[model samples]
Target: MESTAKQDPTAFKRIEFLVVTKNAELLSVSKDLVEHYKFRAEYSDSVDTVDADTRLSSSPMMILISLEEIEGLQERMKNLQQLRAAFPRSHIVAMVAGDESTDDCEMLRGSGARYLVLLQEIKNSSKLYYLAALLVQGTYIPVPVSDLFPSTQVNFNAYHKLVLNQKFLPVIFSGFTFSDKKYRQLETAQQVYVRREELGEYRKYIETYHDQVGAALKKRCRVMMMSLMALYSEILLLLSLDCEAGKKDLVQSKVSEFVQGSQDLGRYLKDCPDVWNVIAKALDFQFCRYERGPYILAYAVYISLKADWGQMQDVVMTALLADLGILDLTPESFKTLQKKNEKHLKPEELERYRHHPMNSLNRVMLRELEVSNETKSSIVCTHERNDLKGFPNQSPADKIPAEAQLIHFCELLDRRVRASLEDGILTHDFVRKQVWEEEKDSLKRFNAAFLDKIEKVLVA
Candidate 1:
């Protein structure tokens, strides 16, 4: 014959418990039970008028109720039935102090109470906590008297059914607002999705907020200017990279794209004068120096003519793209070149160095960037000297295009200022004086019309 010995009723483990009772002694008993069970627990002291709204939202693993405190068993049963409806699988343990009538026990048992612990068995704190823990763990402990209370052996089928029906919609939508209530309602797994959704929503919210603030808004314009300044700082860092390894080309290409994209974005804002004003503010913030000041003014002209003169736009775009080539040159190579004696270079090496601007121009042409024949002519003449001393065709003043002459002057000014700053020359006024002393005569050779624009932007 097979052995028919029953398993120990209290040998199960529980994780979390919620105790609900009006009696302070019962609350104490429940707390003691939770501790003995080796489980984490929380409790509500006012069971008769307990805030079910808050408790239900809390969604604890198990609820413990004292049966002796119920004045009307039927109403309490209806309320418990509703709670079971909301949280189907949650364990409900009812504590009974004395021997009850069969009807009373049956009433409590029918009302979704999974366990009816007798007062005598729970005299010690350890046993009560252990029982509560077991209830929370969802372990099926046999009722002390199964024949008298068959319904005490609750199943998790109702809870699983409710969960399947609800899906996970509540957790998904709760992330938009930052609230403690929202946080508490979600489990750890659910919170992960909430956080991801919140990030995406936050990005969109900020973008919309910026649009609503308008381009003329001083605060909004300041932020845009600050962001562009940061981008320029990143550009400076990228410009310092090694070009021989080909990494410089990659950085230059990215910068070129950024410039092109920003120009295109500016075109879209032309109809919105307020937005255009903001972009102008950003430009003013970025090009505060004499060298950058010319390029800034030129860029403003290019943007202004984007809609009116297609050919001019193409020319300006090409000139903008050409700046990337200079950016692609290694800082170390530039420094070494600056230190070398220009007079010592043999004819062949000097010839090669003279064609560096043309080499850059060819690369841009090969990329098929939007540029006109006039623009290409301008780009080729960027290095030509007015005194007929510059190379790659040693063109005289009349042969050089006005746009190219202006760009050449701007480029030289930028290089000189940058070189002086790197050498720890602190004062801009001193740097300007030194640069003017060296290049004042050469700069005078620039086309009168082109020079006037440069002077207005830089000198005025």
Candidate 2:
């Protein structure tokens, strides 16, 4: 490792990171990370020593604190708070034991820390490096605490079929106000669809409540949703494996688990029907972050449609496998396709892109699973347009199944909504407005009546 003292002081005036830890293993790992990433860093066993250093008068970008396995947990947290108070601008990351309790973890977050991770999770040096990189880029990684939530629960009888009329909508969200102090009425809210103006405010109010639930609860729900996505990813991985025959039983078991989990999540959301809007936004945030983003987005949208358990399972299965063909494409090929416009694609590339839907259908048929005919059609027709302008056969609206339209609409909507959020715009309804008014011409590609019904289900 390069000696910090021998480095050019004038050139490396600002330290990029500061690692404070007493644990021998953590200290060793931190040294390796600093050497590997070439970070201008300072190391100390105590916060006081770091604070007293004259060169560190200007705070480092991030502070990594390791919590030792000691009896005086409160004392350690107090020291952490002292560090936070000293460098108010720096990002504080607390690394705690894997078996740490939820309450203790919450305490760490509450002590002005920006992030928390289990020490066990970073035992792998590669994982630690990845985590550090993400933190430096300001990506928020929610702690895994799904155990705090209740297990799979179903209570359709408790589902509230909220009729979102002007008179009833206010009563449901009795005390929600915007930052500017205007109350949210959701006047156009109905069992089917909300007006464009109402959708943005409606999503904002729900997101605010979700945030108000505190970090621990927020993380718990995020973990629960990510677990569902992990199962979907696992299934995709199994299908791509060489030993397909041997993996069939495992795939079947995962499929069963996913169906039950989806149903359980659906019931849990429906049971608190008044808050369905909130859960929808939350799921959107979670699903948009996962690798199989559209798959989970389709799941979230289908669940909102209020389908029966049997229909829900089929829709979920369809969503899960709808884009399986895309996996056959190399990573670079997919990246190029995503980054380039359709007009920029070469003839052969365009042909391959157009055939992915059929490729997916053929792959699924070969599996010989218990997938229904409706699911099979949905998987293949996901990209087909209502006006017969879509690919893989140009199936018209009449020929395209409802499940296919639902998933397709979700894939489009997710891109718009996620983009809006990513651009730092708070108005989610911006996407809805684009669909209903700005891009009404594009809506011709989808079933008009079905789109109306799905939009209503979204607001309801």
**Candidate 1: RMSD over Cα atoms?**
29.3
Q: Model 1, which residues run further than 4 Å from truth? A: 1-315, 323-349, 420-445
Q: Whose TM-score is greatest here?
A: 2
Model 2 agreement with the true structure over 1-460: per-residue lDDT tens digits = 2234226644334455778888777777777666655666778777766745423444565688887654466876887788788776567777776565667766776786666655554453133453354334222222211211122221111111132211111222223312211212222222222221133233333343443334433433433444565566557645642223344677888888777666655554543423322333554332134344433443454445464322576667777888777655533335454444346666776788788788777777666566888888888888888778898998877988777776776676666665566687646555555654533456666766775665554443
lDDT of each: 0.45, 0.55
* Model 1 lDDT tens row, 18-133: 66667677765665444434444555553445444334443445677776676677856765675566556566767775556667666876878755665443442123443343
| lDDT, model 1 | 0.45
RMSD of 2: 15.4
Instruction: Judging by lDDT against the true structure, name the best candidate.
Output: 2
TM-score for predicted model 2 compared with the true structure: 0.51
